[model samples]
Target: MPYSRHLGPLTPPAWHRPWFRYIDAVPGAEGAPPAPDPAQSAQTPPADPPAEPVDYKAKYEEAIGHSRQWEQRAKDNKAKADKFDAAEQEKLSEIEKANLRIADAEKASAAVAAELLQLKAANANGITKDERALLTGTTEDELKAQVAAILKLRAPSTASAQDAGITGGGSAAPTSRAKTLAEAVAARINKK
Candidate 1:
């Protein structure tokens, strides 16, 4: 009461206006503070913006086209590989055929060499070509047996018996006197 009585004659300052009046006032007042607009204060901005729509069908079609191209390339590569494999298989088969032919030729050569060796051996064993031609046998052993049998059947020479006055074709023996004379002549020839 004492302070109020002392300030009763003084007026209150204009700066003591209410807060709502200042907030409601218009902007650009002469020497006045700017005021906030009620409409701008009542509304709020959005947190995020809306996005444009995407074309999923077109993207899917492009991806499928690329996948098909890759699949076709893979098929082409597989076909090429198969073609090369067939060529290689054919070459291998040809090589096998050539090896078979070589083996047959070697076998034939060995057979011919064996036959030549057998012929040489037969000739060395005193078998004449004409006698061998007349002989009949399939193998070397059988041919040798035939040749031995033929040699056995041949007659002995008669020249020596004829010199001793013993006719080989006859059954008669030399007379004692003729034998004695032949022996004496043989002894004399041996001494000379």
Candidate 2:
């Protein structure tokens, strides 16, 4: 593009512009040192003086003190971290124990509910108390099935001798010798 003098002047000058403000940049510029003469250089000593000794021990001790302070801070941070970790571990163990207790309670509740259901089903089926203890099932249908099985097992023995037209078994004479009360007690004691 062609140069535009008007636009260039409108733009703000950057920090690196106006180079003439700096001193002694180029050789042979204004304020430049005069050329040295060989005759004056051989006679005069160098311009700068010798540097003094650096305080090495004082600097070394300060550095060591700063490093020790940082080390102590690191140790304090580690101790706090250890304490937090222990607290977290304790909370985790407590949570685990509580979860175990909840699981056990849930298991026991399920077992009791199942037993109650079985007993209710047995009672509804008109089962005897002794037979009800034998009933075992997790669901109503299974309990009903168990009750039916028990009833089926004892179906034949429900009738008495009167219903079968059979008699004389109740009044039969005893074949064994009759024992007195004292002899019965003595026998019972001996058996025990």
Candidate 3:
């Protein structure tokens, strides 16, 4: 026989053999059987049959009814909102009227308070209510001056005492005479 060189083994090693065999195998090799037909597979259920034609008219009518219901609801909500707005306006008007009334009452109260203060001031100055009512002066100072003039006019005059013949009452007879005249004038005032 002729000499020949054996560079490698005829069959590959065990670890390399499986990889080579897998690559060499056919798509449907005997070791791995063919996949089951989709129609006959137990895992896949049959597809549903063709559905009947849609009833577009009935569907459109139902959609229209729903739309109408929504529109009516919107209208009702708007009506309620309008009613609430009207009520609020009425309440605001009422509040405004109440505010006006309050303002008027405050003005009246201020006037009464001023009058009361004037009356108190007059009373503090020993002016009686009846005397103040008879007095006619626009201001307190004028009223006070008028009251002073009236008091001065009502006071007994020295000329009246001299006319009564009541000179200085150093003597008992003149004193008695002065006392009598004074009593007579007091009695006359009381009678009036």
Best by lDDT: 2
* Tens digits of per-residue lDDT for model 2, 100-172: 8999999999999998898788778888988776566677876666676666654654445643336635534
TM-score of each: 0.26, 0.34, 0.29
Q: List the residue pairs that clash in candidate 1.
A: none
lDDT string for model 3 (1-192, tens) is 443246353564568766564355454777655766766786776688788999999999999999999999999999999999888767777779799899999999977765665576567766666656534444566556555644453456554455455664344344344554565445335534
Ranking by lDDT: 2, 3, 1
lDDT of 1 by residue, 70-179 (tens): 99999999999999988876878777979989999999997786567547655766766765543444456655655554454343534466544556445366644455
Worst 10 residues of 1 by lDDT: 150-159
Task: Give the TM-score ranking, best first.
Answer: 2, 3, 1
Candidate 3: residue pairs that collide: none
TM-score of candidate 3 versus the correct structure, residues matched by position: 0.29
User: Which 10 successive residues of model 2 have the least lDDT summed?
Assistant: 173-182
lDDT of each: 0.63, 0.68, 0.64
